[model samples]
Target: MNILLTGGTGYIGSHTAVVLAEAGHRPVLLDNLSNSSADVVDRLAQITGTRFPFIEGDIRDTALLRRVLADEGIGAVVHFAGLKAVGESVEQPLRYYDNNVGGTISLLQAMDETGVGTLVFSSSATVYGQPAYLPLDEVHPTGATNPYGRTKLHIEEMLAELAASGTNWRIACLRYFNPVGAHASGLIGEDPNGIPNNLMPYIARVAGGRLPFLNVFGDDYPTPDGTGVRDYIHVMDLAEGHRAALDFLAGSAGAGWHAFNLGTGCGYSVLDMVRAFEQASGRPVPYRIAPRRPGDVAACYAKADKAADQLAWRALRSLDDMCASTWHFQQRTAR
Candidate 1:
C-alpha cells in the first residue's frame, strides 16, 4: 500500500513511518517542517534501511496535495499535521483553527478529488476535556476545554459527517494519550522548539541537565502521590498502532468514522514519570510543586479494550521502556 503521510516528519509521524516501512507499506512523507526538522528523513532512512520520498509542503495546498496524490499514486493517507500546544493554543486560537481544522478540510477535499478514501487521522485525548469516568472510553462525552482540543473535536465531527455522506470512506480517529519515548536507535525523538509543554520531555530535559527542575503541577491531586496522573504510552507502541489501523482499514471490514483510544489503559502520575526518568538516566531530578494549570485533569487514562478488540492492537511497552528510550534519544540527539 502506498501511503501519503502528512506531517510525517514530526515525532509520532516519523515513528509511524518507520513502522509502516517495516510492515512493507510505502509511506511518502508530506510535511511543511513547521514543527519538525527535515533531517528526520535522513534519520528514517538510516533506521529503516529504506529511502522513502517526501514532499516539502503543507496540507492546505490542495493543488499540491492533489498533484502528489496523482503523481505518487497514493492509496491512503495518515493525517498528522497540526499545531498541538494547549497553552499556546490559548494564546492563538485562530492559528489553531486555521492550521488544524482548515488543513483537514483541505486534505479531505483533495482526497475526494483524487478518489482516495482511506484515512487514519491523529486525534487527541484532550477532546474528552475532564474525564467523566476513571478510564475514558470512545463513547465518552467530548467537550474540549482548550482551543487545541476544540480543533480536534471539530475535525472529528467533520469526519463523522463526511463518513455518513459516503460508503467508500474508511476513517479512523486515533485519540492518543500521552505519547512519550523515542526510537531505540536514539536517532530521533520529540524535540520541542521552545519550552516543553508535556511532562516526560521536560523531565527528560531536567534529568539531562538541560533544565533546572521539573515543575510538578499541583501535587495535591487525588492520585497516589497527590499529583496528576495520565496514560503515558510509548511512541513505538503508538507507531505500531498506526500500522494496525492501516491494516484494518486495508481489510475494509469496518466502515464509517471509527474511533479508537491508543493508550495503555493505566495511569501514571507526574512523580512516577519523574522517578522513571531519574532511574532511566541515572540522575536525580529536582522538582517544585506548582498550582495545577487551568484545564488540567487530576487523572485520565483510557479504556483500551476497544482498540485491542477492534483493531487487534494493544500497547506492549512499559513505563521504564518509555523513559529509557526517551532519555537515550534525548542524549544522542543533543550530542
Candidate 2:
C-alpha cells in the first residue's frame, strides 16, 4: 500500500511513517512544516534505512493534493495536519477551524477527484468534552468543550456525512487520548515550536533546566492526588494504532465509517506524571500549584474495548516507558 501521510513530519505522523514502512507499506509524506521541521525527513530516513518521498505542501491545497495523490499512486491517506492546541484554539478559534476543518474539506475533495477512498483521520479524545462518565468509549456522547475539540467534532461529523452518501469510503476515525513519549531511538520526537501546550514536554523542559518550574494546574481536583487525570498513551503505541486501523480498513469490505478510542484505558494524574518523569530523568521537576484552567475535567480516560475487539489494537506501553522515552528525546535535543 502506498500511504500518503498528511503532516508526516510531525511527532505522531513521523513515528507512524516508520511503522508503516516497517509493515511493508510505502509512505509518502506531505507536510508544510508549519508546526514541524524538515530535518525530520532525514531523521526518518536514518531510523528506517529508507528514504520516503516527502512533499513540502499543505493539505488545504487541493491541486497539490490531487497531483501528489496521482503522482505517488497513493492508495490511502492518514490525515494528521492541523492546529492542535486547546488554549490557543480558545484565543484563535478561526485559525483552528480554518486550518483543521478547512484542510480536511480540501483533502476530501482531492481524494474524491482522484478516486482514493480509504482515509484514517486523526481524531482526538477532546471530542468527549467533560466526560459524562469514566472511561469514555466509542459510544460516549460527543460534544466539544473548546474550539480545538469543536474542530475535531466537526470533522467527524463531515466524515459521517460523507460515508452516508453511498460512496465506498473506508474511513477510520481514531480518537486519540493524550499522546506522550517518543520513539526509542530518540532520533525523531515532538518538538513544539513555542511554549509547550502539553504536559509531558513542559515537564521535560523543567527537568532539563530549560524552564523554571511546571505550573501544576489546580492540585485540588477530585482525583486521588487532587489533580486532573488523563489517559496518556505512548506515541509509538499511537503510531501502531494507525497501522492497525489501516490493516482493518483493508481487510473489511465496507464503505462505512468507524470510530475507535486509542488509549491505554488507564488514567494518570499530573502529580503522578511529574513523579514518573523525575524517576525517569533522575532530576527534580519543580512545580507550583495554580488555579485550574478552564475546560479541564477532573478525569478523562478510555475504555478501549472496541478497538481491541475490532482492530486488535491496544496500547501496550507503561507510564514509566512514556516518561523514559520522552526524557531521552528531550535530553538529546537539548544538546
Candidate 3:
C-alpha cells in the first residue's frame, strides 16, 4: 500500500511512517515544517533504511494534495495535521478552527477529486471533555471543553456524514490518549518549540536542566495521589495503531466510519510520570504544586478493548518503556 501521511514529519506521523515502511507499505510524507522539521525525513530514512517521498506543504492546499495523491499513487491517507494546544486554542479559536477543521475539509475535497476514498484521522481524547467515567471508550459522550477539541469533534462529525453519503469511503477515527515517548533509538522525538504544553516533556526538560523546575499542576485532584491521572500510550504503540488502521481500511470494504480509542488502558498520575522520568534520567525533577488548570480532569484513561478486538492491536509497551525512551530522546535532543 502506498500511504500518504499528512503531518508525516510530526511526532506521531514520523513514527507511523517508520511503522508503515516496516510493515511493507510505502509512505509518502506531507508536511509544511510549521510544527515539525524536514530533518525528520533524514532521521526516518536512517532508522528505516529507506527514503520515502515527502511533499512540503499544508493540508489546506487542495491543489497540492490532489496532485500529490495522483503523483504518489496513494492508496490511503493518514491525516495527522492539526493545531492541538488546548490553551492556545482558547486564545485563538479561529486559527484552530481554520487549520484543524478547514484542513480536513480541504483534504477531503481533494480526496474526492482524486478518487481517494480511504482515510485514517487523528482524533484526541480531549473530545471526551470532562470524562464522565474512569476509562473512556469510543462510546463515551463527547462534549469538547475547549476549541482544539471542538475542531476534532467537528471533523469527526464530518467524517461520519461523509461515511453515510455512500461515497465508497472507509474512515477510521483514532482517538488517542496522552501520547508521551520517543522513538526507542532516541533519534526523533517530541520537540516542542517553546515551553511544553504536556507533562512528560516538561518533566524531561526540567530533569535535563533546561528548565529550572516542574510545576506539578494541582496536587489536590480526586485521584489516589491527588493528581490528575491519564493513560499515556507510547508513540511507538500509537504508530503501530496507524498501521493497523491502514491495514483494516485497505483490506475491508466496510462502509461507514468506525472509531477506536488508542491507549494503554492503565492510568498513571502526574506524580507517577515524574518519578518514572527521574528514575529513567537519573536526575531529580524539582517541582512545586500549583493550582489546577480549569479544564483538567481528575482521572482519564481508556478501555482499549475496542481497538484490540477491532483493529487486532494492543499496546505492547509499558510505562517503563515510555519513560526510558522519552528520556533517551530528551537527553539526545537537549545536547
Predicted candidate 1 versus true structure: per-residue lDDT over 1-335, tens digit per residue: 89999999999999999999988899999999887888999999999999889899999999999999999999999999999988789889999999999999999999999999999999999999988896899999998888999999999999999989999899999999999999999998998667788788888888888999988879888789999899999999999999999888877575788899999999998888888888899999999998877667789899999999988999999999999999999888943
Clashes of each: 0, 0, 0
**Poorest lDDT segment (10 consecutive residues) of candidate 2:** 247-256
The local lDDT score (0 to 100) that residue 106 gets in candidate 2 is 100
Give the total clashing residue pairs for model 3.
0
TM-scores for all candidates: the values are: 0.97, 0.98, 0.97
Show where candidate 1 strays beyond 4 Å: none
Q: Rate the local accuracy (lDDT) of all candidates.
A: 0.91, 0.92, 0.90
Q: Which lDDT value does model 3 have at 47? A: 93
Model 1's alpha-carbon lDDT is: 0.91
Query: Sorted on TM-score, highest at the top, how do the candidates line up?
Result: 2, 1, 3
lDDT of 3 by residue, 209-302 (tens): 8999988779888889999899999999999999888777766444569898999999999999988988888999999998877566788899
Candidate 2 structure lDDT: 0.92
Give the Cα error of residue 286 in candidate 3, in Å.
1.1
Which whole-number lDDT from 0 to 100 does residue 222 have in model 3? Answer: 81
Runs of candidate 3 with Cα error greater than 4 angstroms are: none
